[model samples]
Target: MKGLILKDLITLKSYGKSLLLIFALFLFLGLSSGSPLSGAMMVMPISIMAAYVTFSYDKLSNWDCYACTMPMKRSEIVIARYFVTIILSLLFFAASLLSYLFTAVIMQNFSEVYLLIPSYSVLFGLIMILISLILVLNYKFGPDKARIALILIFILPSIFTALITQSNVPMPVISESTIMLFCTIMPILGIAALLLSYLMAAKIYQHKEF
Candidate 1:
């Protein structure tokens, strides 16, 4: 399992320079706009993109077929991918948080930093759920078709949001307790989704003819 994860990390090493550039760009944007959340908002999508690139590399190299020939269990392969995705997500989150803090310091608005914790926690949970769905799609459909599905997954949300904004639907007012409850529940749900996704991917890979 360690070897499998190491291989994926090595494959992703080529992305190092690009990742740094993106971080610097977003950091600058946050500073210029005086909005730390702008930098933080990039975390989920960037992590997802990086994670998907690993899948693309695996497909191009026919890594799965070769992996299956080895003595490792199919479930381990799925787990390794999940681990890599999670590690990438956390790394990006840390970078975004640092950017947020730096921007807050420059703006002399450190008071708002604490306010971001709950929001960021919720965002991280949602990101996990999104990555879970991506993993299942990639495992079941292969990377090529999965890319199309992923595009639709992202586009439909934007279309729905646009419709909602055009309709001018009044947003509901919620109590602080309600918001806290939601933040608490979402991470638990995200964890459940991730576990289920792993099981589904393992089952798919088990019968998959590589």
Candidate 2:
């Protein structure tokens, strides 16, 4: 698994400049525009791109076929990929957090919109859900069908934003108890989603022909 992660890190090094540029641009926009959501926006693309690019690299270099001949189990390969997603997601989450802080400093305002929730937690939760779903779809559908994953990366976020906008529910002011409940539950749900996604991917990979 460590070697597997190192391999993905090398793959990332080959194309990571573009990812950095994208995040920087978004960070600047988020800070300049005084929109807290903008930084959080970059987390999704960074994660999905990381996952898809790793898979794409494997296919392009015939790494999957090569890896099967190595000593590692198929389940290890699947879990390693899951670890890569978590690592990349955390990296981008930190980038987004810095952007949020810069926005607050530059704007001299830290409103309830920014303070109602730990923005990093929200972005992290969203990334976990997005990555889990995307990886499962990628495994089940395969790379030539990657358009499906790409479409999903965009669609799910849009739908979520739309639902929030159309629901017309004002953002609620939470009691300490409510906040505690959410803090406890959200991580559990995220973990459950990741575990389920890993199981799904492992099952798909087991049946897959090299």
Candidate 3:
């Protein structure tokens, strides 16, 4: 598992330049907006970016042949992909938080940023859910249709957020306490989703004839 994780991280080396450029752009946007929305926008694009890289391995490289020939079990390979996805998502997530913090500092409203954390936590949970769903859909339906499908899923969320941001209604009873409770419980759910995605990927890949 450790070896597979190391290998996956090493594979991301070539993507660093593109990722860093995106981060630099995100930092500028975050600083300009001085809002959590800037950070959220950055990660929203990156959730798909992470999925693209994680799955593109087999399609682009000779990795499928070598990984299958080795002692690593199919299940282990699936677990490793999910593990790497989680780690990268988390690192991006932390970057988003720091980006928002830097924005607040630049705006001279550092004290106002505490509220951003809860919203960021909820958004992270939702993104994880979407990522797992994307993986499963990609596994079952292939990538092209799945990519189109996820883009359509955004319409409803965009509408809901627009309405909430534009209206007088409260945010669905999600008080700070509820957010805290959710924050406490969400990581467990995220981990469960990660495990389930790994198992589903393993099941699909194990019997898939290469």
Candidate 4:
């Protein structure tokens, strides 16, 4: 898992500048607004781009065989990718907090909206986790045809929601006792998604001819 993680992190090297720009821009605007919602909005594209990077890394490097040959269990590699998603999700959550702090320091917000960040971050994290996992599944089924995975994971559901719901999804129906409900439930969902992804990836990896 550590090796797999290190390998993925290394992939970040090529896109570090773009990733930093995404984080900085979102962090800047989020802090300026003192709005978690805004912070979440800023986090969206970053998550999407990050997922793309995660999906594309191995095929582009032709490293699937190399990864399989390493001293690691197939499950470990999948777990590492899941870990990558969680870590990045947490990073975005932290960025949102930094945004809140920035706004507080700048005196740009009339009311503190720090609390709004977590739930929304969780929601976005869920989306990214599910999207990325499904991409892994599709890529597993067919190698060079992975481009379709991006569309299914990232675009199709969004387009369906937009087409059916007119680009707006309603807010959660739960009571806002505090951040705990939203934050707690989201991490649970994310963990579930990650575990499922790992299992599926492990199954696919073991059977994959590469």
Per-model C-alpha RMSD: 1.4, 3.2, 3.1, 4.1
Reference-based TM-score, model 2? 0.81
Model 1 lDDT per residue over 16-47, tens place: 55667767866887877778777767787787
- TM-score for each predicted model, relative to the true structure: 0.94, 0.81, 0.79, 0.72
Cα deviation of 134 in candidate 2 (Å)? 1.1
Candidate 3 collision pairs: none
Pick by TM-score: 1 or 4, better one: 1
Score residue 150 of candidate 4 by CA lDDT. Answer: 52
Q: Name the best candidate (by lDDT).
A: 1
Q: Compute the lDDT of residue 87 as modeled in candidate 4.
A: 69
Across 1-210, the per-residue lDDT of candidate 3 in tens digits comes to 999888888888665555666666667886667653465467765865677565666557767678898987888877777777778787777677666666666676665556676666666776777778777776666666676767777677789888988997764655767669987677667667766776787798788765
Best by TM-score: 1
Q: Stretches of candidate 2 above 4 Å error? A: 18-20, 112-117, 156-180
Q: lDDT, candidate 4, residue 44?
A: 54
Q: Which of the two candidates, 1 or 2, achieves a greater lDDT against the reference?
A: 1
The C-alpha local distance difference test score for the whole of candidate 2 amounts to 0.75
By TM-score, is 2 or 4 better?
2
Candidates 2 and 3 compared: the better one by lDDT is 2
